[model samples]
Target chain A: MFKRGTLVVVAFVLAVLLTACGGAPAAPAAPAATDAPVAAEPFKVAVVMPSTETDLAWSQAMIDALRSIQAEMGGEAAMQISISENMFNVTDAAAALRDYASAGNQLVIAHGTQYGTSMFEVARDFPEVSFAWGTATDTGEAEGFTNVFSYNASAEEGGYVNGVIAAMLSTSNVVGIVGPVEAGDAKAYIDGFEQGVLSVKPDSTVNKTYTGSFGDTAAAAEAASTHIAAGADVLTGSAQQVVGAIGVAKERGALWLGTQSSQASLAPDIVVATQLYDWTGVLKDIIAKIQAGTLGGTAYDLTLENGGLKIVFNSAFPGVTPEMQAAVDTAIQGISSGVITVLP
Target chain B: MEQLFTLTTLTGILHSTIRLATPYLFASLGETISQRSGVLNLGVEGQMLMGAFAAFFVVVTTGSLLGGVVAAIFVGALLGLLMALVSVSFRAEQGISGIGMYLLGLGLSSLLFRLTLGSVQSVRGFAELALPGLSSIPVLGPALFKHSLLVYVAFALVPMVAYLLNRTTWGLNIRAVGDNPQAADTLGVPVIAIRYATVTVGGAMAAMGGASLSISAVNIFQENMTGGIGFIAVALVYFGGWRPVGVMLGILLFSLVSALQIWLQLVGIGIPSDLAVMLPYILTIIALALAPRRTGQPAALTRPFNRGMA
Candidate 1:
């Protein structure tokens, strides 16, 4: 009897495991066939992301933009979207890209920089399908690809603006940065932030540390603690991993400036402001170009001047005084009008 | 470099080191018990992820930290039980099954998170409980005494586990099963039962280690948030030479080095941040190499037992 019970338990657990594995990778059931003569054969778009759609960081920004576009174009019926999220492995991501392309996704979006090599390979095979990937400006033109689109966010512009706000509100002349890695957009944001802080308070100290990972929340939290211990009153960082740092900042009552996405929802009280990425304008442009037969070759950038990167201040935190707000607005205008160069 | 020597900086490093090491301590110590019973569970990372999600989910919905911790422990044990059924009862390859478990835990937790809560949310997890008198000591007080309840529980488990593994009759039976299962079986020891218990306990502890992160350390959960900490915990068991105190020391050394590297970057002493970040990992390899070669590996580890076969 005991042996029989054990077998039953094992079978049940295995069934649950199989179901869980089966549930993922099955892209949310394609918006149930609309009976009312679908609006213009739903523009099929597929996206392969490095992390989950709700990471509230890099991946979330793109997903939110796509959702807004879908809403604008009339719902799921007018704009069909398929997402294969958490594709951290390049090989697996390559396979996912191929699968989407073969399945007739007209415009396939590989939403991570690491997917460049695989994307170009897949784009080569499906010349008719338009491919887009970003936080990069490589259109793969030199590499001989035409159906590929590249978009980048001039993150430093908003990073500099956030830095200006941090400098104005910081009581202790010391600021801290919990960086992920010293490369890509993360690097650009940090460099620009340091410059903004120094531009305002030349004597203020900004201690920066990269935890060598984009997902090591524990390490990020420790870095935040280290910063707080060193007398830093204002903190800021980019990437999805900043959630951990934000938690630490909230506990220590340190003001935080965010980048890449709006982290105001994570900790409204302590997250004073966030430099959010609004990719809607860029996505629409890419869609239009693709529809107009301009499959590739042009690289686009999301900048403050183009109204793609926005600085959103949290109302829950009263730290941004009218003067501080004015300083931020001035910095934004300067960057947008080309009067202020964010990076050297 | 001199800035790192200040009392505040030193104490700060020490404080963060304890907080950082708590998860490793729980997971590795639990791994020690499992390996001591001759079952090597490589699915610890998966167990931790499930535990983290469970704890975070419960806390967000119920607003009770205790409820979160309990849910984590329960979910962890259930996964552990599944591992036992696959390895101990079915006699499948332990390593392969463990990996399968890990993938299952990862996918299930992520799917559940999406299906239920849908977005990233934070909850107030464990609050630091400063000891009555010891918390007042200068430098060390704030550094060591003030931490979430889980940190204290994790450290306390080390000695209890040590005593359980060294002094108790049950510990002897576990050691016998790991070292010579056939002999243990002939002598009337319930090998399968002991293996199940140890593996299940290991899963529970690994999960708690994960809970420590979501409910205590960061108080937030993201997919794969453990971020290979579970694998590191498994390595610390080998580094500690399969002993509880040794595992505790290993965890301290690794976490202290990690803490030091973070400090090095904070002080900006001119070393590149990339090189600074590699310090803990590089130091761990060096320490593992330099340590005395005392192979205390369980002979029966990874060997599924059968009554009549050798």
Candidate 2:
């Protein structure tokens, strides 16, 4: 009996090891159909994202932009695309970057800021391959890497806009910010949001809490609950983890202001508006530069003026009165035209 | 700070503490049972992830909360059975095998989720089952009585588990096997069977703990959504000295500290948020260090038992 049990155990371990070795097949997005004849050699692009492409936040925004660009360029035949999702580990992301470059992808976009170092390291080896990454603006020119490109979104612009609407709709005069960490785009969005709230309703209380994690949904939910408990009728936060907070807001009937992407779909009744990051403008520019043989050494910023950042309010939620809409529109125009700076 | 003492704030913190501690309670209680039976499943986190995914997947597909829970239990037990085969039968190093199980669970669940659902989706999970009369009793009622059914099950398991471990004959046999497998073997106790049973039960409970999060507390599943709760549950077993009630107290303490920090930040306290977040871990370490000498640890833990050996 012991011998049989040992044999079974050995077989199970071997099966698990084999499965691990034979990694899961990559699921590429279905190629869009077009009547145009296929190009002999298409302009291939590969993207590596930290979370799944459908996270409805950071990663989703980029994938949506890629698909949009593909459609505009006459579909998959004109612009071939490949994606590696859930590449949260820097080592794995670096490996994916190198693999895509070796496979002759013309433009490789590493979609998370955490991949900046790894992207640069991989960019050095493939001089002919154009690489892009962001929520940052360093193009690695100082580090002397010409094949690398960087982009950043003026997230504070939309964050400020969302804040204005949230403050306008808030009945409690207490708004809450559920932040992921006190760094990167999350910090910028939170800071801009607070400023926007204070600018609109100077006496309103703005409470902020950082869960110190990018993906701890449980913590985010608790933080949201705490916010609601403290008389916050309106809440706003950034990062993919806000899905948890959104669920809480929906349950408690508190209005949620989103950033990074349009999260109204998560809770149509509660998510009043979102600051969406539209990367097509940035992607188009990068593609244009690569096609023109300007491989890298330039940084791009997604601003409201460039139509890369947008504040999309949910029409399902009737909380956005005409007065509130006008206020939000004014804030958007002020931030975009350089008349009112988002950050002092 | 003085404003933080309001009835509303205190009730909110208490409510949050209970909700947050549910997963820990489930994971640590299960870990306690497994540890008492001579196995240390470090892969509880992985099992929890698998459980979370399975429950969420089932609920989204079939809209049956019961089916989701059963799926979690089934997947968790399978993983636990795999652990038993590796550690108990193959005589592999328990620590390494447990880590392997953890990685496998994490990877497999993520893969399955991508293949099936392909995105983050939410479901209407278990609703708060407010105990009719009890739920109306001002502060305590709202804080303790108005929770999902899973919360009650998790807390109810405490005394049940304590009784099973201390009063029942099967519990005595399990204790004997974990304490001295060879001696128990000589005494005609089924040492291997007891270990297998305890470990499998541990896996089911751990998965249920995960289900509590996805289907009860958060009502959504994200990749690595359980975060580090599983590993913390393992440490909590040590903190509780392998007792169910002790484990409950430890989970509550950790969760209470976490809730307090959230409240402190919400009240606009001037302390750095980073330091506030660290409060729970710091307090947990201090409590563990000040805990009574580790006297309840099973003697034959992590040791694969074989007859006619040693």
Local distance difference test, per candidate?
0.90, 0.88
Chain A TM-scores, candidates in order: 0.88, 0.88
What is the fnat of model 2 with respect to the true interface contacts? Answer: 0.69
Query: Candidate 1: misplaced stretches above 4 Å?
Result: A1-39
Runs in model 2 deviating more than 4 A are A1-40, B136-138, B289-292
Give me the overall lDDT of model 1: 0.90
TM-score of chain B of 2: 0.98
lDDT at A46, model 2:
99
Deviation from truth (RMSD, Å), model 2: 6.4
Candidate 2 accuracy as lDDT: 0.88
Each model's TM-score, in the order given?
Answer: 0.93, 0.91
> Worst 10-residue stretch by lDDT in candidate 2 chain A?
A24-33
